[model samples]
Target: MSFIHLDRPDCPEAHRPEAHHPDRKLTARKLITRTGSSPPVHCGHVAMVTRVTKNMSAKAKQSNKSADKNANDRNDVASKESDAEKANPQWKLISHEQINTLLDLTVEQVQFQFEEILGLKNYQTCLKEASLLDYFVSGFWWTREMNYTCQQISFIMALLQFLLDNISEKQMPFVDNLNEFAKMISGTRQSPSPEVDSLFDAEQAMSITDYLKCSLFQNYQLYEFLFSQPREELLLGKKVRLPASLCPYVC
Candidate 1:
């Protein structure tokens, strides 16, 4: 058999290079030589991987920012608690700091100076009034529970204000529906942080209930008897006589 030479006219294609197809632009990257990894990498794949990595990094940064914010908030609360505690030992009972926005007297401080009302004993009129400090101490000890809302704090402050305001009154305001108040207090419990959509997130209700039971509710009848408007001394045991002026309720 005669050998076929590559340069022969009949063997023209054997020595010539392959021609490029018109569709090579579209499929150019689809074909590649095996290099060190024996796998092909395309520009599109590289871009896709870069985008995914960038997204993941951004998410990680957001997560870190949230964590840092929570941490800073916790630290701020701790600082406030420390400052409050230093100002008054009674603040020790508070489990957490509260946001008292309505009235500055609720949590920020007392209206009556401590040195004037709760601090001195020798200057106290009615020797029994000296024990007011003890009353506050015991009450605070009973109700130190804190909450996110201002309900419990405001209620406590209101009660204290009423007590102080009507200390010398013939009759202090009395709850006509003690049972209803009790029911409201005993209504519901909640997590420290319930859903925003909740209608009855009243964890402080029970806290107030326990507090009143421990401090105020137990002395309900005593408060009415000691502070409420008494019948006229001349009409006592005979006929009832109303007070000259009634308590201003709307104010």
Candidate 2:
């Protein structure tokens, strides 16, 4: 009996067994010889790549959020510090012992004098006025000693001249009393007797250098002693007012 050789290499196409289905037909040789991947494996690889890309995108978004939040936090802190500075204008220096010695008084005595000069019923008000005076006087001394520009020196000198003019015109009791107290402490004239007209005339053509020679600038220690206290202590209970004429220069 003759038997059919199905697995022979020279098998005829017409006589060979047909594949199970056209779409599903595949052989080990065909799979190995193909240059591209199979559908199932390709889909799985694409899905893995997509998942990795999504994870990277998520991480990037999270990093951006963290950066934004940190920026906001820094800005908030800066804003708060700025607000605090504005709300409370304080003296830059605080050498209590030096100030006491300069004034020839104890801390307690300085406080008392401040209260008396400002006519402050509350202790806190005295401290605030003292700090303000310190800031003003220190600014003046620094500007003078550091050789500030002529324009800058002139502006400050003009402001001071304005304040002095106002004090004389208003006859502010606090300034008069403070001047007297300063004179007593220094054993030198703090200012010309209040009766002696104007120390500086806005209309005058005097130089800033000439203005500095006046008693106000000469007796700077009086002001430094006034502002030695803490700023918060100064504004605890009262409102301080700048002279109306000086308001334009302040802002």
Candidate 3:
């Protein structure tokens, strides 16, 4: 029977260490690799394999911990930014009806006092576009009779949206915000400091805006005069009678 050759091919005979001391009766069959060396030096020393493996494992764990720390830091920054935003918001969570109940008759509403008008733009989705257009055309302005096209309605609607959204306790956006509104409608600019996104990004807003720019934004002033409704003014008349002098005060 032929004997099986078990010597490693990489450990050549010339590189094999000769056994000089009798303490190590090493031969080619007894090959041991030296620690911390490449090319697998054939020697008679035990390699410190366990120590090297432990060091590499420790380095890997440290890298993992550093990555986790960086992730936590990013998450903390995001959370703080969100909290800051929550602490200071530009617009409050209030409805149009609630605002209407608190407002006084505005100068814009004065025109309505002299006409049988019904051209108020409602923010609620309950009113169909057809009905809204009908109100605009028939609200004593005779928009259809004056040859006002569909684009005119679009311009009127954009103005109403800007007015309603930017309205404050004792302020409205008329001539003061006219330029800003025009820029917004033409898709050229956004609100200066709004909490919301560009208005044209909303449903039907972009189409209407395009039509407004293409057709009827030129007659913005005339349309404002014809179909504008006055807001109700809030007035309180209180009469107080003082004692001992029969004096009365009205405020």
Candidate whose lDDT is highest: 2
RMSD of each: 15.8, 21.3, 18.0
Candidate 2 on 71-150: residue-level lDDT in tens?
Answer: 99999778755643332222223333433342455445645554554355654356545454443454445444645443
C-alpha lDDT values of all predictions: 0.47, 0.48, 0.42
Q: Could you estimate the TM-score for every candidate?
A: 0.31, 0.29, 0.24
Leading candidate by TM-score: 1
Q: Write the per-residue lDDT of candidate 1 for residues 1-251, one digit (tens) a residue.
A: 87877656667655444322434343333334313233457889999999999999999999999999999999977875564333222222232243232223432253133324355544244333434544554444334344333434434444554454454452444453355454333332322223323212466555566666756567766545444445322122555455657534323
Q: Give the candidate order by descending lDDT.
A: 2, 1, 3
- Tell me how far the alpha carbon of residue 194 in candidate 2 is from the true structure, in angstroms, after superposition: 47
User: Could you tell me which 10 consecutive residues in candidate 1 have the lowest summed lDDT?
Assistant: 190-199
Better of 2 and 3 by TM-score: 2
Checking candidate 2 for backbone clashes, the offending pairs are 128-234, 130-227
